[model samples]
Target: MNILQLSNRLGYPPKDGGAIGIYNYTKAYHDLGHDVTVLAMNTKKHFYSLSQLPDSYKSLAKINAINVDSSVSVLGALMNLFSTESYHISRFISKDYDEELKALLQNKEYDIVHLDGLHLSPYVETIRQHSKAKVAMRAHNVEYMIWERVAMNGSIWPKSAYLKLLAKRLKKYEAQRLNVYDMLVAITPEDSKIFKEDGCNIPVTVCPAGLDLDQYKVDKTKIESMSLFHLGALDWVPNQQGIKWFLSEVWPKVNSKFPELKFYIAGRNMPKNLLNMNLQNVEVVGEVESAIDFMNSKSIMLVPLLSGSGMRIKIIEGLALEKSIVTTSIGAEGINYEDGKNLLIANNPDEFVTQIERLIADREMVNDLGANARKLIENEYSNFKLVESLVEEYKKMIV
Candidate 1:
């Protein structure tokens, strides 16, 4: 089977959750002997030089990247305020990318044109027009839900109103094009249900972000038994919001309770405020060389996401690495986690403090949770196994 994967950003390094999803799926598809071609948008936010990528990775697909400046501007945001179009989706529309895609479609024959996320929805019609392939969209999140949650929790005045407006527009935009793709692959059954309730007429499959377990290896030697760490793309609004909320509401009490315990925050594009916060017992290691390495070294993984949709890829990786994790319900969305078994859930700051304290005191409980976490990933979220579901769906679509 020949498949073309259209990514919104760089996938090789898989810096963010979205990229990790794309990267894992693509690799799995390739390993399964599918002729996968990756045509990714090298956007300003996740720009990477193709030359920097290794031959081993390049061999997996006929890799191609087009420079797409999918950057938000003040004027564009203001213009969107008047228009009904979603500023979130509109930023990805690029003439350069479209032209390149047009040429690529004309040259190669693919059985499936896989859209990585909502960001690539704009190209569905173009793909339909140029090729005979069935279009399949991977919905990483209920796109509008993220903004709606952000707006609900927003503190600022005009910004909150503006966020609400964006959410409304995005919801409409999503609804209008529900049946555009031949099939919809949701990251969770919960998202699939929402799509069905919201009038998605296309075939929807519950396909969570599956991890390639080989990449995650737990080095028990490096594990810090008394430390806590949070790793994610810091540039993302939800991550920044989560970190801020954690510092203001959750961390203070926990720090006071356990003064010797250190909290390390690491990710790409660290916000200036977070980097310069100078919080005691907190190490702001902005960006690390490898996400898996950083995660392995930490004692407890913290995912304090207040508002974000989609499966937390890092959480899956952490689980695979046998790490004891504590995250809010929102942060733990899409993944099936037992509160006491696989990972601990803490919705509020107090709960977070309690969970952290619990883990710190009981080594046996931490080990039990970590082992259960690895078992969960092994049983359900293995990419080697999950890819078969997606492939079967694609085969059906093609037939």
Candidate 2:
């Protein structure tokens, strides 16, 4: 099948979850003997140069990236208050990107045109006008749901009010744009249900992010048995909010109990407030060289997400690496993980402290949990299986 993937950002260097998700699918589709072409916007925040990518990867797909200035301007954001269009979706609409996409449709026919995220949904009309490809919106998350959670968790002041307004605008946009696609490929069954509830009449499929297990081979000998860590994109509001909650409420209790235990935080674009935080035994290492290497070096992975939607790709990668993990119910959502068997699930500060202490005291339980977590990935989240299913879905749509 000929596949054209439209993304709001580059998928190479798979540093963060979003990039990893996009890159893995493209690679899997290409490996499955499909002609896959990725036309991604090289945004200023997550820029990539085509020259930097390996020739081997380039051979898999005709990877083309166009420079897009997706930077959020205060003035533009203020102006959006008067406009009915969603600011979140509007920022991604570039004339150059549209022209490039138009040119691609004019040049070659495609069996499937997958929109990598909701940001690219605005281009569905263009895709329809240019080609007869089956348009599939691979929703990374219910875009409005994330903002709704943010608004709910925020204070009732001006910030919260503004977030609520943004959520309202995004919700309307999401609903209005629902039927424009041929199909909706949700990352989780939970998301699929939400989309249906949000009035998405199109056929929806549950296609969770899968791991290339070969890349995540775990060596127990290299593991740092005493360290705990959290890794994700810190610039995201949810991550920043979760980390703050952890430091202020949960981390202090855990640290008091285990005074020697050090918690390492790593990710891209560490905010100034987070970097300047003076929490005891908390080392904020901004952007590690390799995500797998960093995970291998840590004994336990921490995902203290307070508010977010969709699946957490880092959690899947952590489980695949056989790392003992402790996360909130929100953080572990869509993974179908057992609380005590696969990895620890904690909802509050007390539960987080208890889970951390349990892992610290019981080595055998840690090993069992890590092993179970790895097995979960092997059984349910195979990249080959997921992509094959996606291809089948595409075929069904085309027929």
Candidate 3:
């Protein structure tokens, strides 16, 4: 089956959370012997550019490189007073890409048109209007909820207030358009429920975020340190808020107990505050080549995510690498890991400190939890299993 996979950003090297999910997913479908092509816009906000895509990508799959304008509009700026969060604007949804996509559909009939992010939904409607393809949308997280979380942050006040208003508007817009697609893929059951509550009429299924286990194999011989690692794209609002919350409330508690605990932070585009806050025991290493390698070296992974939707690939990656994880309930969203069994769930600073102390003091507990976590990921959350479900859904949609 020929699959026209649409993505908000180019999916090579899969740096960010969303990109990583799509990249692995499409690869799995490709492995399943489906003829897959990706049509993506170049957001250009991240590390890689169009040059990152090799000749093979162009030959194997139709890769569309549309340069979209993501700047805030004047109306968006005014909306900021009520809600600082703004919907990402893309001027690159050109008639050219639409015609190109339509032409592809006209030439080679596709069984499924899988749209990756909500940001790419606008184009899905365009495709539906012109092409005879079954449309399915994979909701990473309800964009409105993401905006609500962004607006609810205490770190950035005026911006948060503005985002709150934007969230409401986006919620209404998205809710109205939810039924247009044939199928809706939610990253979590919780998100699926939210979608239903918002009147999404399409068939909703829980499709948790995945990790490339091959890239995250456990290394038993490596000497692990008394270090804690937290990684996310720093530019992302959730990561920014999570780190701040950790630095202010959680990390200080952990530090007060274990001053010698080395806290290593790694992610894309570290903000100035987080970078400058690099203290005696804190190391802010922004953007590493291999996040799994970094996870293997750490004794425990700390995910103090407070406001975020969707499953955390960071937690799953840690599990796959046999790193014991300590995270907030929000951080462990959609992951089927049992708290105190495969992972330690902590919401408050005290709870976080207690978990960290337990993990630090007991080697056996850490080993057991880490091992169980890896087992859970291998059995349930593998990319192979995820793509299988996706394939089944595609067949249903087509039938």
lDDT of candidates 1 onward, in order:
0.90, 0.90, 0.78
Model 3 C-alpha lDDT per residue in residues 1-399, reported as the tens digit of each score: 889898767777676687788788777777788888787766557325666677755555666666655554677576545643335523334565666667777777778898887776677766776677888888888778777766766747666666676777678767877988888999899999999998987788787887657777787666456688888889887888888888888777788789888898999888888888756678999989887666776788888887888888777777887788889888888888788899999998899899999988999998899889889989988887788877887887777
Name the candidate, 2 or 3, with the larger lDDT value. Answer: 2
Clashing residue pair totals per candidate (backbone < 3 A): 0, 0, 5
What are the per-residue Cα lDDT tens digits for candidate 1 across 49-155?
99999887898898999998889899999888788789999999988989989999999898999998899999988898999999988898998999989888744
Candidate 3 regions with alpha-carbon error over 4 angstroms: 47-51, 54-60, 72-86, 89-96, 155-157
Candidate 2 or 1, higher lDDT: 2
- lDDT for model 1, please: 0.90
- Per-candidate TM equals 0.98, 0.98, 0.92
Candidate 2 ranges with C-alpha deviation above 4 Å: none
Total residue pair clashes for candidate 2: 0
Q: Which ten residues in a row have the lowest lDDT in candidate 2?
A: 150-159
Candidate 1 local lDDT, residue 110: 88
